[model samples]
Target: MTDDQTLADTTPPAAHESPAGGVFGDPTAAPLQPPTVRRQWSIADILAEARVPERYARVCLRADLEADHERILTELRTLIDVEGNIIEAEDASLGEETNTARAHRLNDELEQIKADMAKATWWPRFRGMTSDEFAVFNKEHYPKKDGASLEDYNNQLVAATMHEPQVTPDEVAALRKKLGMKAMSNLIVKATEVNTQGGVDVPKSPSSLQNLTRQ
Candidate 1:
């Protein structure tokens, strides 16, 4: 199993879990299917379950690392939670904490979970399981296409929660025109000639921008 997949195994199922809308807004808006659960097991737990001999386990582990080593390693260093906003619930559900306070406190909790999880020895010892046993264990657990460990699964969770949805190529072009996030910025012109001196303080015409850009 991959590290992220293996890492996810550490998280036991919550007795009663519910969707908590976080930084990315409503979960319903950009719905991606959820990752399947794989129970987290300790080193001994893995050994007891798998019947593989030592040599083959090492080979299986090494091969997985070589396939996507850099990307996998980089993901480990990347923070899983969104910047600032860490509370795993909707704003209304938060009850009293203001948005600013919620962000600050959630940041602390996310950092601590990551720090403690780092010390767990799930990945380093996977190399010891027999390939025969690994195949059996892996089939039952690491089902994601490229998944080889729990860490990969954790990264997937992070991706689902925080990764922004992609805009299509056409949509990107349209948004660029609207936001003025383009190669060449232009000074907006108003037909009424409001403050013709180009005073920065005056309100720029939002309604006219699209028409002017298309021209």
Candidate 2:
């Protein structure tokens, strides 16, 4: 009958909702729990999980080849100096042959030595192993010493995991012989760095817009 009474009768009840829960109901009712959040995987994330980081080590099997390379380089530098003097002095001859001719001969020799050295160098690729894989590898290849400390165990783990998948045991033995203990240790360090530290160098950005577009 009264306007105020009529309005009150038609009006809906006020919601006794929790601000945090955003749930509407009786004040005495429990608040609704939030829905669980889940991680969404992108293509990049999936690929990253599946991808294995790789590293390469270059080892020369012939110390003699390295020596020859250095010797030829020295000879080439000396020949170049003499060649410059010959041109300045206008001398056509040096011993049995002209400096220009001898310089060319030395250049040929240097090139050949470089080729030989390149042939002797081996590029071995290594991939990082998963923790489970590394554990098994360590047990098989480099077992922990008795009463080993944590540091020693970790060191052995690293040493065991530096594996060149392409090379055979005989090839590895040959490499060790050529590299010696010091160089072999250094190579292992490099492999470990790549595996643990993501040692692939980030390529430099293009210097100009043209280069970027070309790429």
Candidate 3:
């Protein structure tokens, strides 16, 4: 069909063509065959030979077996990636739901604690109460009606009575007497002494005395 094929068919043989033998060799001699022509394949031919329908074919069929294998693997990988995305989304949603449930439970506990604290008269000043104000408040622990629950009241009482800043009745009496005194310096001194005995001592200043006297 091609030019070489025509030449192969018609070319005359030279006596010195080959060192091995003439074109007509001994009866058992191997004749020279024409050079092989490389075949060009179409997509249809490639698919027919590939045979992916019935079962997984081995690499021997395709010319570029490695390249073809990578393509197949890439498709499989894409499918796997899609499934993984769906699974990850579900896991994230479940985690968020769990966190929300936990948050609600903690909130309920906090509200219960607040309700309990509401029943006491003078609650611990931890959140907002200052040492100076608490010193004035002393250990006055009582139940309040606003948000105080009975349990909160009981806890407050236990906390208040246990290890309270000891205030002697004598000291209160002395402070009352000192507060009634007309001299500001004397009143300040007495308040200081009362605080010292109560465990959280405050320094008495003459400036405070001057202010009180002016008032």
The candidate that wins on TM-score is 2
- What residue runs in model 2 are displaced by over 4 Å at the alpha carbon? 1-44, 47-50, 81-95, 131-159, 162-175, 181-183, 199-202, 205-215
TM-score: which is higher, 1 or 2? 2
Ranking by TM-score: 2, 1, 3
Estimate, for each residue in 1-215, the C-alpha lDDT of model 3 and write its tens digit: 11111211222236333333333233345644645986787999875764111111011212233354455444434334554431223355633645345445545655554444444222111111234644544445323444433332222322322223333444434433433222222322223223232332232333335367677
Candidate 3 yields a Cα-based lDDT of: 0.34
TM-score per prediction, in order, is 0.18, 0.52, 0.17
The sequence of per-residue lDDT tens digits that candidate 2 reaches over residues 145-172 is 6533333333343344456655445554
> What TM-score does structure 2 among the candidates reach?
0.52
| lDDT score, candidate 1 | 0.33
Candidate 1 is scored at a TM of: 0.18
Model 3 is weakest, by summed lDDT over 10 consecutive residues, at: 51-60
Error of 3 at 111 (Å): 0.6
Backbone clashes, candidate 2:
0
